[model samples]
Target: MSGFNTSGVLSVAPARMLVPILLILMWYLGRLHSQYEPIVTSKVSSRLEEARKMIPSVKLDWPIPLAKDPRAAFNSSKLALLIEARPLPHLPPLILHMMAVIPPDWRFLFIGSNESIIGVSRAYSIKHQQVIGKLDLVELPPPWSIASKEDVFRLLTDSRFYDEFLTDVEWILKYEHDSILCANSETSVDDGLGWDWTGAARMGDGHFSGYGGLSLRRVSVIKRVLSFQARFNDSEPEDEWFGKRLWVLPGAKVASRFDDAIAVEDVYMERPMGYHIREGGGSLDKSVWGDAARRKEIFEYCPELSMIMDMKLERQRCPDDDGNGDREMADVQVTTAVLGEGDDAKALPNDAESAVLPPQPPPLPQPWKVSVTTFGSPLRTGID
Candidate 1:
């Protein structure tokens, strides 16, 4: 106290007052906390506010499981392939129908040009098939061409093609736009899985007659053939080129004659699994489709052929024509009359032309009628 002034005098009594003030502040804060606890913990009544509170703090995207992928359920080794460059009108429906009728285990592949790929992929059903993995539409890149028949032939004959694009493929069911499988066929395609190569018969009695329009082929056997043999460009068709060697290839089970035919092309059998109408029936085998009864049977058996083949209604036939391939020759009597005198009168053999009775005009000449005898015969036998 002697060293300090009045400002520095001892203040222990003031310090003693701080404890009560601190206690009062702590008690007031405790009251404030207790009073607002219910409001902070109360359940929200507004739906939007509740939803906001329930939402995840961090955003995330997850995939939903809907339809099953078809590839998981089917055997991808068995491939049904259709290679086309032109976008035909019937492609979408035809492809869908084929998928429906073929074994469910089989997967389909459509290899086409850009235009053709776009043409078919536009269909809702086709898109659905692609989504389900039941089908795939592909357009090959450069150094490969399918714009012509010869180009396709070259493609099938190359071994690199199989290695590059057809990995793990064991079998190939090749079909064209003009070809169709009979939904009513008694035999399913699975029955012929044993054969290395089988298709439409070219000739009734040929040693090797497996036409390629609609065919089932074993990839192992094809690869075996391609390993040692190479196809000449633009020479023989791919089917025939392979067929000739496949027939001779030891252990190869190639279809021969009409007995083993898988489809109907030039030769007719009781019931074929399918039909390969060349040019969509424009070029038909007479022995197979010429007879009226035979055509009726074919149409009755596979009415789906009408989907791709060009045909006329039965009522559209000529009036005097018969159901048979031949048309009946009808006798047409044409009459003509002439007018004037001398040479003009001679021109008209009718007696009315020579008569100068009242000054009446002569009748017009009638056009000559053509009598068609027999219709041209249909193609009997050839390679597809």
Candidate 2:
């Protein structure tokens, strides 16, 4: 004890205690840093918010196909066009242009957040007054607000929004704000988004590819994905999030060569069913949609551009057709498909087969009631 100085022993004991104190202080600082960092906090907050979100625990199984039934009703009702949007001057035109060209019969549900410039929808509806389709602009409130691109969480959970917006509607096409259907798009016999509608054999795995823009989702599939999307933690590149989340399902499949996503065969190779306005520096790199100078080039490939902003609410009668969009689109579809009955033609025997009247096509499917809603403001669209 005499050899070991008492003062030295006391100093050693204090040093050991300081080490624990420093560690405790460091742990507290680490959390404080995490709280202030927007990126770090956002990730944690989103996960927590996602956890708080209420995705129904129910499982949505694949609905049986009614293709064989003559009475089989396709999901023509409420083709909810869920347009992802942000605050952009061009947003209204983007919506209007596609609306003007695509069949007016389709229902449209616009999904945005507080940051999104969704006021245009109401303004357009008020100004035009004659546009059809139940155009609804919905700005989700906080904890559910998904109006920004960074709000990938909201987009992934959109099925829940759709659940509230669309009732009894079987199909929902989630198109980004930057997307628009080709004014003259079409699907030939074997060219329906890589689906013949005959069997899953031809269906492309859209879930693997992130082309949520053109992918058509049946409500059942939507429910399945929404239920699963809720439990999913990884949320980047929303389209791929859906692709990875939904594709694993028994019947979930997406087929498209759309940009910003993965896919099998290019569904509409050189000619996409729709257009995506994208940034530069990528495969098939060309400024599209967003570029003003290059818009002419885009128009060469997509006539829909010509219709944007140029749309007038008054019905302009087509010389060759009435002002009906469905009828006009059918003709355009037949013309653009480039192979509506090519297989039928090739299958025909070298000799003429007796003409058989194909069973009269069932009465045209009745159109569903279209409804559009806007938060923070009312969304009124279409002529009664």
Q: Whose lDDT is greatest here?
A: 1
lDDT, candidates in the order shown: 0.84, 0.49
User: Model 1 Cα displacement at 43 (Å)?
Assistant: 27
Candidate 1's residue-wise lDDT over 309-384, tens digit each? 9888886666555686566654444346566666464243333323222224558887766554444775344332
What are the runs in model 1 whose C-alpha is more than 4 Å off? 1-70, 335-384
Please state the error at residue 328 of candidate 1 in Å: 1.8
RMSD of each candidate relative to the true structure: 14.9, 31.4
In model 2, the number of clashes is 5
| Steric clash pairs (candidate 2) | 113-147, 136-372, 136-373, 206-254, 207-243
Total colliding residue pairs, candidate 1: 0
What TM-score does prediction 2 earn?
0.45
TM-score of 1: 0.71
